[model samples]
Target: MRPFSLRVFVPSGDPTGVLIATRDDGIGKATIFSRSLLGEVKGRKEWNLPGIYLLVGPSKLYIGEGDPVGKRLEDHAAKKAFWERALYFTAETRLNKAHIQHLESKLVKLAQEAGVVPLDNGNTPQAPALGEEEYAFVENVLADLLLMLPLLGYPQFEASEVAAASSDEEVDAPHAAATGKRRAAYSAMPRGLLFHSTSKDARATIETVDGGVLLKAGSIVASEPAPSFDVWMPKYAQMRRQLIESGVIDAQDGRLVVKQDQFFSSASGAATVVRGVSSNADGWIGADGQNLGDLLRQWKQKNFC
Candidate 1:
């Protein structure tokens, strides 16, 4: 991977709230915010520009394009409860309606091919006709978007190798954001930490990400929980039940398979879900061969020091 820098700016002085991701080249920018913060970002000039958007939640994903994305987001906000995060892309250059339509179409196709999440859109629309030059330009915008999105805690549409990429957005106009290194090392290990979990009946892989830990797609999960699993991790116990009910985890041939990447608040929780029993450090092996508890301790020490 070529070396690049990504910036994430949090408005409202809250990193967990509305934020923006952008690159130094000023080619494009992304605005990310929860559904609750939609009103806060509705006033930005970029919202009125031609752009493509993805509305994502725990259960479904919707991809669309609008000449001015703000209106569509507002419409979805009123009609859709499944999406918690609304992320959209608009370029610094003049992108017309056709450009965004092409982006929307391509994004829909890719997400469908990925087959990781159920879609809210009933049908994918055909891309608008574009000249060779316009197509090339829009593709560049899409490439930048795919690279930066995963770092903002969204890895849904991207491929495994590309999902490891990071972004460029600002939560507020005329404000700057934090920078991240896009290097070979980052590609090799997307978030700098990896963990493996295995048991007699299941095996899985996980990585520490910006907000939490990610259980990789295609990981084998235990088909059944331990007798005392609820007592061990009450929160994840309920979550696991919901996941199964929602078809996020499907049972096939006595194995429970995760269909897409899932993020957890901690490594312990992810490990518990994977192995179907109480787990912490002992349940997962970290990149350096240290248990999660040991790795967590070292991280705490290093940061505090």
Candidate 2:
């Protein structure tokens, strides 16, 4: 990966209200400000240029573009109640109304596919026409914006696990080596963990991976959460519900089965959602035939000692 530099300024002593600029020439700049700081930043010169912007809230996202970007933000502040912060992207010279419209169209599509946050935009604009050079330039700008957005606490544009897994790029040698070790260890193990739903005929295989756990496709989950499901954190419950609602998992043969591979932040999180009960990460067995806790201890000794 190519290294890039970012310069961020906090104007109001509040880190949430920021101005982000890149070292790369021709790439655009971004300003991320809270709705409360609109009065302080609305008159800035960048807002007068044609740009694409995002309105982000706790659970929802909206993407748009306009010339004289200040006016568009003002209108959204008056009408859109969910968003608490806005991020605007504008170029010094290359960007124009057509370029911004194209960016808006592409961003909306990406956010929807990411499914990291729900979109509030009712309509998606069609991408505008541009020459090959201009299109490539805009793509570079968008790439920078995507990298910066997540660091700024706006993750709506982050790629989904499936998308990341299906990327065409070859894995780095070190990562490929580690993955090979994991697969070999798993193959030699007697068995993986099996989590069973308390309220239904559902079960799933649990496997450890780098940084987290994987719930393999075709693994089963309860069709509905059990009455005692409150044993798990609300966020885990919500995640399970979202998976069902999104049709990522569906009921068949009296149980819900995952349609695609899924990742969780921890073994316990994956287990809790699969079993609809409280779970302990240490209880999960690893490929070495040791529990997760013991495996982690061995790994730490080898890598960190």
Candidate 3:
């Protein structure tokens, strides 16, 4: 992946409030805000521009396009109780209604295909006809939007399992020896270094995201939480129960199989959920047999230093 610089502006001066993110030489900017801060960001001039928006919740997502985005956002705020945060991408007045519609269609379709987050959108509209240069403009804008998702701690749109399976290192190389039982590591974006964690009967794959680690779907996790886990990490234990009950991890068959990619606030949290025990993610191994924590430290030193 090519290196790019991102600049994030906190308009309200609160780190958790409205954030405006953009990349140098990029086509568009992403404005993010929580539902409570809607009124504060609503009056901004950019909200009146043509754009595509994402409404995010704990386990669901909604994608839409707005000629002037704020009207749709206000409608959602009044009716959609699921979304807690919202983000919109726009390139000032460069995008038209058809462009935003096409972008929204692509996002909704991909999110549904990922099968990670259940989407509130039921149907996808067809992308409008565009000339060669127009098509390029929309696709370029789409790429920029995707790259910005990780900045807000959203990685649901990028499927790690799919990327790992299709990656050149894991599939194209015939003689490369895999280090772990599942020595498959692939990065679909920046900060997405992969790891594979295992127990006697269960094996799972995961990768680091911006704010957390994401456990991939189809991973075999322990069906029961360990007794010590309940005593030590009670919040994670509760999260496990919630995931099981919400059908995120299917447990009805006596075996725990994840149906969709799952995100946890921390690597250890993801490790504990997958292994059903008290665990540290630092020990998890990548495809190269390097410790997850060590690889990350190296990455930080290389990037941040």
Stretches of model 1 off by over 4 angstroms after superposition: 160-305
| lDDT of the candidates, in the order given | 0.71, 0.67, 0.72
Writing each residue's lDDT as its tens digit, candidate 3 over 22-89 gives 89879788899999999998889988999899999998899998989989999999999999998998
Q: Candidate 3, residue 270: CA error in Å?
A: 40
* Candidate 2 accuracy as TM-score: 0.53
**Where is the poorest 10-residue window by lDDT in model 3?**
163-172
Worst 10-residue lDDT window, candidate 1: 164-173
lDDT of 2 by residue, 1-305 (tens): 36766677665676656565554542777888888888888768887888889998988989999897888999999999999888898886878888888788778877876678889999867878776567656666776677777776788766554311101111121366555543443344344454322334556766555445578888888664543242214456667877877888887776799988787645556766776655544545544556654554455456545
Best model per TM-score: 3
How many clashes would you count in candidate 2? 0
Q: Which sections of candidate 2 miss by over 4 Å?
A: 13-18, 23-26, 162-305
Q: What 10-residue stretch in candidate 2 is worst by lDDT? A: 163-172
Ranking by lDDT: 3, 1, 2
Q: Can you give the TM-score per candidate against the true fold? A: 0.52, 0.53, 0.54
lDDT of 1 at 193: 78
Per-structure clash totals for the candidates: 9, 0, 0
| Candidate 2 global CA lDDT score | 0.67
